[model samples]
Target: MIELRSQQGETVDLICRRAYGRETAENLAAVLDLNRGLAALGPVLPTGTLVRLPDPPADPPRVAVVRLWD
Candidate 1:
């Protein structure tokens, strides 16, 4: 688990992207679950608000790519 303070005009998505390099639905939900009442604060969190973030998944999901020209 990682805890970080919110910067001015920072949102959850931004935080997740900064911490984990990517923001996905799973991570967003996980972060919300970890920090209760965080969503109630609205989109832009107040500066200095404490947020708890879950650790990144050990193995990120892989997406299969399809070649348009083969």
Candidate 2:
């Protein structure tokens, strides 16, 4: 687990992106689930608020396979 303090006017999305390196919709939702109280606070997060970040997966990041053309 990682611990970080919230900066004034920072949003959870920004925090997640900075902390986890991936701010995808799924990741954002997962963060909200972990921080239930912040979910209710919306985009603006108070300064100096303590936030806990979940541990990153031990495995390497997953790669997506994209399809191009039709």
- Return the top candidate by TM-score: 1
Off by over 4 Å in 1: 62-70
Runs off by more than 4 Å, candidate 2:
60-70
Model 2 lDDT tens row, 43-66: 788888777777766874788988
Give the per-residue lDDT of model 1 (tens digit) for 1-70.
Answer: 9999999999999999989988999999999999999999999999999999988889887889999998
User: Which ten contiguous residues of candidate 2 have the minimum total lDDT?
Assistant: 51-60
Question: Which 10-residue window of candidate 1 scores lowest in summed lDDT?
Answer: 54-63
Task: Tell how far residue 4 is off in model 1, in angstroms.
Answer: 0.7
Which pairs of residues have clashing backbones in candidate 2?
none
TM-score of each: 0.84, 0.70
Candidate 1 whole-model C-alpha lDDT, 0 to 1: 0.95
TM-score of 2: 0.70
How many pairs in model 2 have backbone atoms within 3 A of each other, for residues 3 or more apart or on separate chains, i.e. clashes? 0
